[model samples]
Target: MNSTQQWQNVTWFEVDEHQDGQRIDNFLFSRLKGVPKSRIYRLIREGQVRVNKKRIKAETKLAIGDQIRVAPIRYEIKEETDAPVSDKVAQSLLSRIVYEDEGLMVVNKPSGIAVHGGSCVAYGLIEGLRAASGKKYLELIHRIDRDTSGLVMISKKRSTLKLLQDLLREHKIKKTYVAVVKGQVSLDKQLINAPLLRYELANGERRVCVSKDGKESKTQWNVQERFMHGTLVHASPLSGRTHQIRVHGLSIGHPLIGDDKYGHETTYKGPKPRRLCLHAMRLEIPGYAPIEAPMPEDMQSLVAQLRAQKADKVVVSDKDDE
Candidate 1:
């Protein structure tokens, strides 16, 4: 392998402080521009990509001074596959970045943008960020639904990713969400414990339901405000399952407003909301200052409307008492 202008056929990377805590797969994505993420995973699986002379998984975080072996392959930046991001989308992603440091990036991901590309999505938030920043090891530590908007953590260091993932599994990191549901919540506080199972229907659509044979799931919520049409509540899922909060909210008979899957469209009163009225409001990491994402404009408007109605009721009660 020649040490020339072009990359070597098989290159060795010595992880420096900047590279430490970055996942090997993400590192490769940075180095091998134009390569698809799926291909990168395949390389790791086939042992073409290795660390310390042994095959490593894509999620393997590099340590300082670790040596990585990157196998060479025919590479070309295809126009169709490497379609350029529009300036509008690029700027949107750039402006949404809330916090960024050596080890992590927190973004207020917009609703309707998938976290990563797939499911007929040509490119999503992560891809947009990668193109905008040109960083090699940018990776999502957790995911929020495409219809859900809020703080999303992108790990820059492999160590941080591992640590945060561990905390999530143990339910140590606190995540709070605010949502508007279809009916008035009678309980100020309630805990819903149920078992959830996911299934795919004949049409290949996926859904989750509470079943006796499913994994345990729990959601704790308190009514923030009651409305004639619906309820605004603060909800936290104690267990992480796919759609855990959404499913649990549905099980308790207060499906989130704009929940096309588990909620009845006709049940919601007034003008229909433009999007799902759910937002990832805040995140409390064990060692960092709590991060909060302001409610997006659409959801904020709906909540404000509900509040005004509640205040009107109060005024009417006062008049009657007088």
Candidate 2:
């Protein structure tokens, strides 16, 4: 629980022209810095947040000249530091920027770091980048799960953000991931065309599963290496959906190594990977040079082990045939 100071008061905000078409929830999040998203949703649900004196849903769009009322709430406020993020996280994120120009930035996002601050995360990648860049229009172009490390795009201009979003929706942006799975990928090349549905568990955790009534999703995968215990595969998602790559990787009976959400505890028999062995290795935008991220150290170590063991197995097979 937050130890909030009581101020039985309300604050009113007038929507500006530039803020038009923004979701009420997002607008509130931008205004109420350091407040948890759950609390914002609660405020809307309890009729504490009103637009033009009428209760509105979280997804309601804001228009110019509309009045927003926010009831007094308890929240924790932290003092601003020199850096927008902690020193350790800030340094890590700064070092990972692969490409940046006047209107765009690309980063090799590390595993276990959220792209945006939400849920239990206090300050995320975007927040750190914004604090470092001192830019007024920086925003995310797309999102990936916290556990999945890979190429992430950040737009420094609103026009660039809109253009990149349109490209992603049209499947024009080419993104590729390198993943190590528990079993040998049966096909050299395979395409998974499954529909996925997002659902919340009883404990409120979000999860995605394949269902007949879900939205169409497709992923193309090609084997990079076949190991005795696992395989290194390159995966490309044709349709952008939450957990599309992870779930589609599971459909072929080769669940990703260290993927706790969809793979079993006993999934891998080789050296255990430190985290999910998935990396966004490559990204191609229409008007930009292709950006590639090298394999992280942890994944490299695991791959070396797989390669050594695979070599030994091949030698043993040769002797047995003789």
List model 1 lDDT by residue over 222-268, tens digit each: 77777878788898888877788888888878888888887654366
lDDT of 2 by residue, 1-322 (tens): 3334444468899987555655688677767765677678778878999999999986676788999999988665545552256667667778899999988899999999887775567677888877766677667778888889989998776567667877887899999999999877656777788999876666556678889988999998887888989889999999988888888877767888988898665456788779999999999899888999998999999999988884323221212110
Once model 2 is optimally superposed onto the true structure by TM-score, how far is the C-alpha of residue 44 displaced, in angstroms?
A: 9.0
| Candidate 1 TM-score, true structure as reference | 0.74
Best candidate, TM-score-wise?
2
Q: Where does model 2 exceed 4 Å of error? A: 1-29, 32-84, 311-322
The TM-scores of all predictions, comma-separated, are 0.74, 0.80
- Residue 228 alpha-carbon offset, candidate 1, angstroms: 0.8
Per candidate, the number of residue pairs that clash is 3, 0
Residue pairs in candidate 2 whose N, alpha carbon or C atoms collide under 3 angstroms: none
* Whole-model Cα lDDT of every candidate shown, in order: 0.78, 0.80
